[model samples]
Target: MIEVENLTLRFGGLVAVNDLSLVVRPRTIHALIGPNGAGKSTTFNCISRLYRPTSGRIRVLGRDVSGLRPQDLAPLGVARTFQNLELFGGLSVLENVLIGAHVHCGGGLRERLAARPPAVIGHVEHLLERVGLAEFRHAQASALDFGRQKMLELARALAIRPRILLLDEPAAGLRNREIGALDRLLNELVERDGLTVLLVEHVMQLVMAISHRVTVMNFGARIAEGTPAEVRRDPLVVEAYLGQEAAHA
Candidate 1:
């Protein structure tokens, strides 16, 4: 559903991402992983259009994305969550998620001020329910635990009704139970909803347990890309990222 060709990015004279390319297929979890400074986040920014590539072509269904803007892509069914939570602590859970619906809302300021836009209220409720946050819909964002905050972020992204989801470290900093919940939710989405996922994560346990394919990077270059078992058994991956200690695991 998403394709990258000869992707490269530079900051000043240094290349942050070097000739990277990959394809994410529908209803599959395609993971991008690497050591720190491997340009994982930079690659995401390029896909999300937060940073234009210094050189390369990115396409969604053969449509060039190099010239497309973030607002332009939002309506095209691309949704993403940050590595760090970006929720507004002051807003209610429901209100924060409503912000993700911006791309679907074309009303002017007056229309929003008067609450006269089309009825997406049902859509909002449905997203809240999907993320298991319906009971906490009216709660303050700050009141929820870190796990729920992550789920809230997930709900916010789902509010866009995306065909593809870019999730950056959804398992980061979560307790085992929370990670388990995320694992369950992801599988449910893939199996029931048929959503495609592009995940950038460092947690091998979680990625190995779930992802069908794993792409490993080192020093801004893709060193290995293959099925989970293939990636796990790769000598370069164990030597560079997982280490011999983890190789035994």
Candidate 2:
């Protein structure tokens, strides 16, 4: 569903992503794993149009999106969560998600709310429920705990009804139980909802347990790409990212 061909990005003298290439198949969980400074987030920024590549191409659902603006992505069935929380701290949980739904609901927010109240409100409520935030809908986003805040961001992304989801470190700062919940939710999204996922994560347990394919990166380039088991056995992946103990585990 997503393809990166010979993608390169340079920040002055430093090269963040160096001719990296990978493909994420439809309705599957494809993971991008690497150590710090591996350019995983930079590659995401390029795909999401937050950063223009120095060279190469990015295609989403068969269209070249290299030149598209970040706002343009949501309308084309794309939505992403940041590696860090990007929540509107001052907004209510429900209100934050409603903003994401604006892509689907055209016209001014007041007008849409007045005309198609049921559809818009129902959809946002459903998304909140899906992410276990139904009870917190009226709460301020900044008032929620860390894990709940993460889930709220996921809900907001889902409000766009994206076919492809790019999640950067969704497992970071989450408790084991919350991680388990995230695992189930992600599987449900792909299996039942037919969503495609491109995940960049450092949480090995979550990545290994859930991903259908894994691409390992080091020094801003791909070193290995395979099934989780195959990647675990790859010498380059072990040496660069997973290490000997992790490879054995």
Candidate 3:
């Protein structure tokens, strides 16, 4: 559903991403994995329009998204969560997720803030239940533990009702139990809800277990792209993670 072609991003003399290209198919989980400074996040930023690419193009469902603004992505059925939590500390969990519903709401900010229609409230409540945060709807967002807070962010992103979701390191700081739950949740999102996911995660077990396809990057370019097993056995991918001896072994 998303295609990036020969994308390059340069910061003066340094290149953050060099002619990187990849594809995310519909109704599947696709992973972008690399070591630090490998440009996985930079590629995401470019697709999300947070960074303007120095060269090449990005297409979402055949529409050129290279020039589309961040706000414009929502209406095109794109939603994402950051590597770091981006939630309103003072707001209730319900209130925070409700903000995502604004993407579908009509009228000025005042009108939206005045009184939410019953449907919006119901939708937010349902999302809370789905994300296992039903009881915490009225709780202060900052009061939740780290794992729950991450789930809250996911709920808020889903509130956008997106067709494609981009998740940046959604498993970074979670406990093993929480990570397993996350794995199941992501599976349901694709298998049951028909959502497409493009994730950048360092957790290899989670990435290999859940992703239908994986792209490995190094030095700002794609080093390998294939199914999890294929990538795992690739000499270059092995070399990138291990040393030369491991690759040749």
Candidate 4:
């Protein structure tokens, strides 16, 4: 569903990402894993047009997305959550997720501000239920637990109704149980909803178990790309991922 070719990004003396390329298939989960500063997130920013690459190409469903804006990317089938949760602490949980549907709101800022009417309230309620947050719809965003907060982020991204999901470390701060629940939820989206997911996560278990394909990177370059099992067995993957000095050190 997505293809990136020879993507390169540089900031003055540092090359954040170099000659990176990969593909993600429809209705499948693909993972990009590496140590910190490995350029996984930089590549994501390029695809989202949050960062302009120095060179190369990015295509979403055969459409070139190299020049698109955050707003333009959404309706062309792109949505993402941040590594650090970006929620409106002052808004109610329902309000935060409802903002995701901004692209579909079909109205300007004035209309949204006036959506306090009963009609708007009803639609917002349904979106909350879709993310399993109906009971906390009116609760303050700051009151939610970490796990629920992560789910809220996903819900907000999904509110855009994206075909391709770019989940940036969705499991980063969660416990094992929360990660497991996330695993199941992502699979459901892939299986039942036909969503295509490209996730960058550090949790080994979730990355190893849930991904159909895995791409390993080091120092801003592609090192390996294959099925999860194949990648795990690759010597370079093992060297970079398992060798402490190569990855964590």
Q: Candidate 1 has what TM-score?
A: 0.93
Candidate 4 Cα misplacement greater than 4 A, ranges = 108-110, 116-127, 243-249
lDDT of 2 by residue, 50-157 (tens): 999999999999999967899999999999999999998998898888877887677776644444467878999999988999999999999999999999999999
Each model's TM-score, in the order given?
A: 0.93, 0.96, 0.94, 0.91
- In candidate 4, list every pair of residues with a backbone clash: none
The C-alpha local distance difference test score for the whole of candidate 1 amounts to 0.86
TM-score-wise, the better of 2 and 3 is 2
| Candidate that beats the other on lDDT, 2 or 4, i.e. the better one | 2
RMSD, every candidate, angstroms = 1.9, 1.5, 2.3, 3.0
* Cα lDDT tens digits for candidate 1, 1-249: 889888999999889999988998889999999899998989999999999999999997568999888767778888999999999898888877777776666565334323524466678888888777899988999999988999999998987788889999999988898888788888888889989899999888889888988888888889999998888889999988988777678
| Best of the candidates, lDDT | 2
lDDT of 2: 0.93
Which candidate number would show the highest TM-score if scored against the true structure? 2
**What residue pairs clash in candidate 1, if any at all?**
none
lDDT preference between candidates 1 and 2, better one: 2
lDDT of 4 at 124: 67
lDDT of each: 0.86, 0.93, 0.90, 0.85
Off by over 4 Å in 1: 108-119
How big is the positional error of residue 26 in model 2, measured in Å on the Cα after superposition?
Answer: 0.4
| Ranked by lDDT, top first | 2, 3, 1, 4
